[model samples]
Target: MNLELVTVLVLALIFVLATARSVNLGVLALVAAFGVGAAAGLSTDEVFAGFPVDLFVALTGLTFLFGFAQRNGTIDLLLRAGLRLVRGRVALAPWIFFALTGALMSVGAIFAIAVVAPLAVPFARRYRIDQLMMGMMVVHGGMAGAFSPLSVYGLFVNSFLAGDDLGGSRLGLFLASFVFNTAIALVVFLTMGGRFLLGRTEDLAGAPASEAEAPGQTSGQASAQTSAQTSAQTSGIDLYQGVTLLGLAVMAVGTAAFGLDIGVLSLSAAAVLALMRPDDARVCLANVSWSTVVLVGGVLTYIAVLEAAGTVEWASGGIAALGVPLVAALLLCYLAGIVSALASSIGTIGVALAIAAPMLESGELGAVGFVAALSISATVVDVSPFSTNGALVLANVDAEHRDDFYRRMLVYAGLVVGLAPLAAWTFSLLPV
Candidate 1:
């Protein structure tokens, strides 16, 4: 009932509303953080502390590193190999891209939008598939990694849990859900139909027709096509670059061997890579998303206000009081998933865990129940209108196909809503 707590609660609601309506998540997060901090009588310095400096530094390094890799043919090598491997297997491109992206996402601890965007077009062209589908594939694949323990949000959640056994609590359940989610993504891609892409062959074959035309007859079209093709060719990676291999190895070793935090370690690896080729530093820097960094930083600092005001504690109590046990418990978790979808997963999971941790300690819910619920609820947020993944996928699609893209998103969303919760319920019954 405290005024500060009330202010935090209201701010949280407003943040979710803005995000749900497709407002810039980072901007909305910053506004909520600052607004709540001011209302709750927090100092400006304290309010700004939530800015994730470590995350920013690391991401900055990663941006530069990725840039170098692109410049030096590291990423290009990988792309070439990937494309070759995907040859004549266009329908499976999305799934393969998703898996690879998921792996990288875990290491980088941020969405690979920059990396995915430029490359998706080539893969689309090669497979004679729609650009929209290619975009969705990369977006969807990259997001799967976001929920992994190596992800920034995952680390944030684990940090909040403190002594609680997060890895032990839900590792199996999370893995299971990942499998099911992958299956669902595959199903969606298959439903799009492989035959729809055959028409691309005629367009691709038309390249010869242009050569037969006079230099002036098809000059503009040829020039544009050449540029697009060159861009795509540059994006291809060798797949055997020593730097690229070393970088991946270092990321994995740093996380598992040294127990170094991914956010820090990821950027460190990227920095090292950038330093190895200072000539391309600017490209690497350009690749980094300063906007995302600033956004994440602002929100983190702003949420610190709620922590100070004890708003999280109050909200947790309200959620627990909803009364669900046995069969109804599944419904409760599903509803929580929807709420999480409306908010960013990070916000919902953070506040919910702060509340739920104590409940688990009190024996109201088992470790398995908590883990299942959290994982399911968190994953569901990926499909929400406020979802970073959803936004990125939609943004990258060709303007002409946005409606079709959105329609597919809705279908994907329905699948997530149903399957995520079912997996949660099934996991709840397991012995984890």
Candidate 2:
């Protein structure tokens, strides 16, 4: 087999082994990256060149900030505030999470999950809410806003298309993502138990667990009692949490408005928060998603190796040969959704553009619609268990529930992988 083909098959086998057994996928990918790169006649540094250092720092910092906020009772306070906004309706928290995360992403951050997931997952557990439903909403919400004029994903795709002379409507890109993600969010709401939440207010946030709620309860019910105790104990915010919130705001505004680097700003904020409660600094560090870092770092490094080995280009060439415009549009969306789910959301946008530029240049497909298809397809699948957003959700859950949450994320991501690309393509072609 060609080196590209061999590397591609090895990547598939890594996924298979990771799934069939109880092992960290990141570990497998790192081993696979080394083995494959060496087999393909590359050196160690070339293989390691794919490690994403910026992503590593940003994930660590955001988790630190979030963990500090949680440790100091800020998260409980905010969850209470969000509950109040919905008049104590538990179902509405998902929408709140969705909107909040979407707003953050629209402001230019691609890793809105790093900000929202830490907050949403715990909030979902606190209220007897469906974890998959809530987490998926947050991920989709981030996707909904990720193509805005200021968003990292938006700027990259737009610049890529423009550079290739494939003209498109910027407004169209944003609208397509908004409409498609909204539709998907609606599907999640109605199908994933959202209807049960409608007009029902029986479940109060932070209520003490009843005798019927088992200690070994595997999902949402398990977290409620613990969350309730935390909320019940917390009173008004103190000076430390107040400063922590301020630090969070600084990171948000600095990165969104001033175009400050996320890692730097987040680390600066985390440092201030750390100083406020030095005792909790260790706690904050402990909560950082080390597994998530390893997973992203390893998978992306291997993806870089694939690029070096010509696997990516070879695959793109195959997709380009398909003759039908609409069929090709759907497949491109699928390609975007699948790869983006498994790898880097931001990087996949570039890959999608590169893969589709040939089709766009042929003039059979509309450039604006095609970009929209590729844009939403690549972004909305961030709920994958291996993806940064989904891993953040998994990482933030109560430790006892991590295994179960990971499985749920995989199932939900699988469903999105099967359906979202078609939805994105359909929306991209819709008038206006």
User: Which pairs, if any, clash in model 2?
Assistant: none
Q: Tell me the number of clashing residue pairs for each predicted model.
A: 15, 0
Per-candidate TM vs. native? 0.74, 0.68
Regions of candidate 2 where Cα sits further than 4 Å from its true position: 39-41, 88-94, 100-179, 187-234, 335-418, 427-432
Most lDDT-accurate candidate: 2
**lDDT for each residue of candidate 2 in 1-432, tens digit (9 for 90 to 100):** 788779768876876676567456678778988988888777999988777676667666766666777678665566456656777676776887788777656644445677677667665675667777888888889888888755556655665566568888777888788878888898888888888988777444444212114324555765555565664455677788788878878877786578676668777878987787787898778777676567666766776677677776776667766756678778778877887787655555654666566667777677888788888778788778777678777777777777887887788889888988887787546433
* Residue 284, model 1: Cα distance from true site in angstroms: 3.0
Q: Compute the lDDT of residue 383 as modeled in candidate 2.
A: 79
Alpha-carbon RMSD of each model: 5.8, 6.3
Model 1 TM-score?
0.74
Lowest-sum lDDT 10-residue window in model 1? 206-215
Query: Residue 251 error for model 2, in Å?
Result: 1.2
The CA-based lDDT of model 2 is what?
A: 0.72
Clashes of 2: 0
